[model samples]
Target: MNLKAWQSLVFQENQQLNCMIEDILINSSNMFIGDQPLRARKIYHDKQCEIGEARLMEDYFVDNSTYDDAIYRRRYQMRRSLFRCIVDVVIANNDYFQQRPDAIGSQSLSPLQKCTGVMRVLAYGTSIDAIDEYLRMSGYTTRDALMNLVDGVILCFGQAPQVSYIVNGRENNRAYYLTYYIYPSWTTFFKLITFPTKKIYKLFAQCQESCRKDVERAFGVLQDRFAFIRHPCPVWDKDNIGRIMIACIILHNMIVKNELDAYLHYYNPTEFLNNMPTNRQPESYTEDDGQPSTFSTEFELEI
Candidate 1:
C-alpha cells in the first residue's frame, strides 16, 4: 500500500496515535540489514491486526487503561502479535537470536542460549542489572528470574578457549626458550611455544580480536550519537535499566554490522580484509643518532 493509504488506515484504526508506524519502518529500512526493508514492510502490514483483533485489543486497553498495563500489552503484542512476524523474519536470519531463550521462567535454556548470552555479556561488558532490566522490559518478571535465564544462555553458549603458549617442538611450532625469568620469585625457566594451525583456532583468534574492536567502535559511535549514556541513567528499577542497556547493545551491533557490510560492498573485495593488519611483521631498525646501527638490541614480543 502507498504511504498515504497506510497513514490513513493507522489514523482510522487508532486515533490516539497521530503518526503511522509505516513511516518509521519505511524511513528506517535503509538503516537495516539485507531483506530487513521488506520485513519491516511486512511487520507494518501484518501488525495492523484484523478488525476483530483490534476490537479485542481496544477492549483490553479500555478495561485496563493504566500506563503499566498499556506498556505490558504493547510489549506482549509486539512479541506475540501478527506485527511480530517481521521480528520472526529478522531472528530467523540471526542464529544468535534464533538460539536465544524465549522466556526466563522456571525452565532452563538450551546450551546455545547460555553461550550466546555469556558471549554477549562479555563482549558488551553489560552489567548484570542491565541484563535483568532488558529481560524485564522484554516481558520477564523478576531480576533473579532473568539471571537464571542468562545463566542458562551462558551455559549454552559455552566458554571460548583461552589461547596460551605451550612448549612443543615441531616444524610448524614456534618455540621460545626462557633460560631464566623472574615473576616476584626466584628465577624461573621454561619453554613457551605456539603453533599456527591454519585452522579454526587461527580464525577464531582473528574473529575474537575483530569482534572486540567492533564492540569498542560501536560503543564509541553510540556515545557520540546518544549523549544520554555519557551521563548517568536515572532510572531506578535495575531490571528496566538493564533492558534499556541491552536494547542499546543490540541496536549498536545491528548498526555496526550494517556499516561493515556496506564498507565491504563498497570495496567489492573477493576476500574479507581486516581494518588493520593482523600479521606480525618485524619493524625495520633505523639509527636516530645518524650513525650506522650494526646490532639490533630489541625484538618484537607477542603477548
Candidate 2:
C-alpha cells in the first residue's frame, strides 16, 4: 500500500523479483560488503545457515574402540557386519549428497556417520536431540541425514515387480493367501477342524497354535528391534512414512542375511530335538511355596 515500496517492485521480463527483494533486504545498512554499501554478503558468510564444517559423527561411535559389543549392538540394533553393509550400499547409491565448500571446505558427515545416525534414531525411537550430543550434529542435520538415508535405502531395496498369481478357484474371488491362520479358542478350533476325536486332535491343534505364536513372536521381535515403528509416526508426509518403513525392513533384511547363520548354529533344531526330554519339569512360582509359576500353562489360563 505504501507508494515508495510499491515503486521498487517493477517486474522484469526475466522475473528476477525474488533476487531484487533479497538485495533490498540485506543492503539496508546492516550488511557490509567492504566499501560497497548496497552489495549483500556472500552465502558462505550468511549468519542464518550453519553450513560450515563440524565434528564428524563417526569419530565417537564408529571409529572409537571404547564401546563393547553389547553396548554397540544395543545402540545400533545390528551387528557391525550388517551396519557396514548398509553403509556401503547407501554410500554407493546416494551419490548426490557431497561435501560442500566451507571454512575447512566442509568435511561434513561422512556417508557412514549419516547412515548410522539415521539407523540409531530408527532403532531407539528417540528424539533427534537425543543423538545431538554424541553425534556432534544439530537436530536439523540429524533430520536431514535421516531423510536422505531413508530415501536412498528405499530406492535401493524397494520390492520389485514379480509375476502376479491369484488362485481364483473359478469363483472369481479376490483373495490373498495368508502365511498362517489362527484358531482363537477350543470352540473355534473344534468348529474349524474336521477331526472328530478330541483326544487325538488336541496335540495337533496345540502344535498349530504354537506355530501361530511363533509368527506373532517374529512381529514382536521386529517391534523390539526397531521401536520407531511401534511408536506413532509424528511426520505428516505419507511418502516419507513409506520410505521409513521400507528402509527399516531393508535394514532388517540385511541383519537377517548377515546373522542368520549364527542363529542357525546356536539353535540347531536337530541337536535340540535329540537332547529333548520326554517329560519336562514343572516350572515354579516361588522357591519355598511349591506354587505353580505364572509362566506355567495352568497359571497362564487363570490369568
Candidate 3:
C-alpha cells in the first residue's frame, strides 16, 4: 500500500480497537453494577371518596340510618356519637383530615372518610387496600390517613403528669387503691404465698388467682377490640409504630370511659362515686417533650 493510505488504514484500525475496548468496559460495568430496575408508574384511580363519605353517613352516622346502633358500634368499634366527636376533634386539630379541594376543584376525602378508613384498619387489622371497595379510597390515601389520625390523637390527648393522692374519707380506712400492677410488692399486685397454713390463706390464694384472671381477661378484651395491636405492624419506621400503639391506647381509654356504665361491678359504685372529692381543683398537666406534632414529610409521602 502507499505511505499515505497505510497511515490512514492504521489510524482507522486503532479507532476501531478503541471503540471495541470502550464497548467491553461498558458491558463489564453493566454486568457488575447493573442499570436501575424500572419502577412502575403510579396508576391514578378515580376513587369516588365523596360518595364514600355519603355512604358511610347513610350506613352509620345519620339519624334513622340504615344500620342500627348495635351494628354501628360493631363496625366502627365505638358509638356513632363518639366517632363523630373524634372526627370533629381530629379535623379541628389536623388539617389533613379535613375535606379540601384538589387542583381541579374536586373535593377530596372528608374527615369522616379519613377517620373511618383509619378506624377500619385499626379495628379489623386488614390490609390497607382492603377498604378500597367500600371507602372508595386508594391504599396510599388510607395509609396517609392512618398516620395523620394517630398523630392528631397523640397531639390532642397525650398527657404526662406528677401527682400525690390524699385520702379524705373514713370508708375502707381511707386507703388509696393502687391502680397500676407493674411492681410485685405493690398493693395492686397479687403475690402468691410460698406456703399456706390456714384455710383462709388458701381461700385468699384462690381469690387472688381468680382476680389475676380478670387482668388477663382485660388484656384479651383490648386485643380483641383492636386486632391490629396483636398483629405485626407493617410500618418500617419505629417511631410510626410507637405512635400507632399510643394512639390505639388513647382510643381504648376513650371507649372505656364512654361505655363505663356497661360494666356492672359488685363493688359499691355509689360509695366510690361519693368518695371522689368534689371540691378538689384540677392541676395543669405538664406536657412531655415529644417529636413534632406534624411529620417532616408531606402526607402524600407518608406511605
Candidate 4:
C-alpha cells in the first residue's frame, strides 16, 4: 500500500478509539444520573433484644419469678397488675410498642422490654446508658423507647381522670371543683378576702387555707411516689420533661385507683389524708333550683 493509504487506515483506527471512549463515558454517566445516592451500610450490632425480654419476664413478670409482690411494688412504684394493664394500653395505642422483626428478619425488642426500659428510667430517674447491659438496647433505642412510652402513656391515660369528679354546687355546670388561688377571679376560682374584716370572710379564708393544704399534700404524695419528680430531670428537652411528668402523674392516678381497696383496708390517717382529695366544708348553700350554690357558708350574725 502507498503511504497515504497507510495514514488513512491509522486515522480510521483513531476515530474508532475516540468513539469507544465516548461510549464508555456516556454509559458511566447514565448509570449514575437517576440512581439513588450511595449511603454507608448501617452497622448491625447484635444487641440480643430477645434475651433482654426473657430476662425481664423472668425477673418480675413470670408467675414464680425472681421478685416477690412487695419487692415488685417497691421497685416499680406500682403493682404488677397495674403495670401489665399499662403495657397493654401502650401496645394498643402505639404500634411502636408492639414487637416486630427488623430488616434482617430478627425480632426486635418486645413490648414488655420497651415498657420495662421506660419504667426503669421513670421509676429510678437513671441514665439511658445505665440499662444497656441488662436491656441490651443502645442509647438511641432506649431514647426512642422513652419517647414512644411518653406518647403512649399520654395518649392512653392522660385524659381519663380529668372529669372524674363533677362539682355539684354550680348551676352552669362548668365551674371547676378545685381552682388555685393564683388564678384570676373567674367565678370558677374560689376567692378569699385579702383582709377579713367580717366573720364570714374569716371563715371562708380558713376553709380556703385548709383546702390549699390538701392540694399541697397531694402534690407531696406525688413526689414521694415517683423519685423521678423528686430529682432534677436529665432530659435536655423541656417538652419531653413536661411529657414525662404528665405520664408519671397519670401512672400515679392509676396506682391509686387500682389499690384503693387495699389502701382503705390498711388505712393510715396520714397516708389516707395525703392520698385522698380534701372534703368540702359544710359551708356551701343551695340555690332556688336546688343545686348547691357557691362554696361560701350562710352566716346568721347580728352586727
Candidates' TM-scores?
0.23, 0.56, 0.62, 0.67
Clashing pairs in 4: none
Taking all chains together, the TM-score of candidate 2 against the true structure is 0.56
Give the per-residue lDDT of model 3 (tens digit) for 84-140.
888888788887876779987889988888788889999999989899889898888
lDDT values, one for every candidate: 0.41, 0.64, 0.79, 0.80
Q: After aligning candidate 4 to the native by TM-score, how far in Å is the CA of 14 from where it should be? A: 45
Give the winner by TM-score: 1 or 2.
2
What range of 10 consecutive residues in model 4 has the weakest lDDT sum? 271-280
- Which window of 10 residues has the lowest lDDT sum in candidate 1? 133-142
Count of clashing residue pairs in every prediction: 17, 0, 0, 0
lDDT leader: 4
Query: What is candidate 4's lDDT per residue for 1-303, written digit by digit as tens?
Result: 999999999999999999999888787765565675778999967988888888988998888999988998998888988889888988887988887788999998888887787788778877887888998877777889988888888887887533333447634535354555577877767765578988998987888888878978988998888777788877889999899888888888889989888866454466444554244354567789999866543344445
lDDT at position 116, candidate 3: 87
lDDT for predicted candidate 2 compared with the true structure: 0.64
Assess the local accuracy of residue 4 in candidate 2 as a C-alpha lDDT between 0 and 100: 65
Stretches of candidate 3 exceeding 4 Å from the true structure: 1-40, 165-215, 264-303
lDDT of 1 by residue, 103-144 (tens): 432233322223223333433444434533222211122233
Listing every candidate in turn, what is its Cα RMSD in Å to the true structure after a full C-alpha superposition?
28.3, 12.4, 19.4, 15.3
**lDDT tens digits by residue: candidate 2, 94-204:** 763554555665456556556666777889888876765555556777788888888877777766445444545544333232233364444223222345378667766
Error of 2 at 216 (Å): 3.8
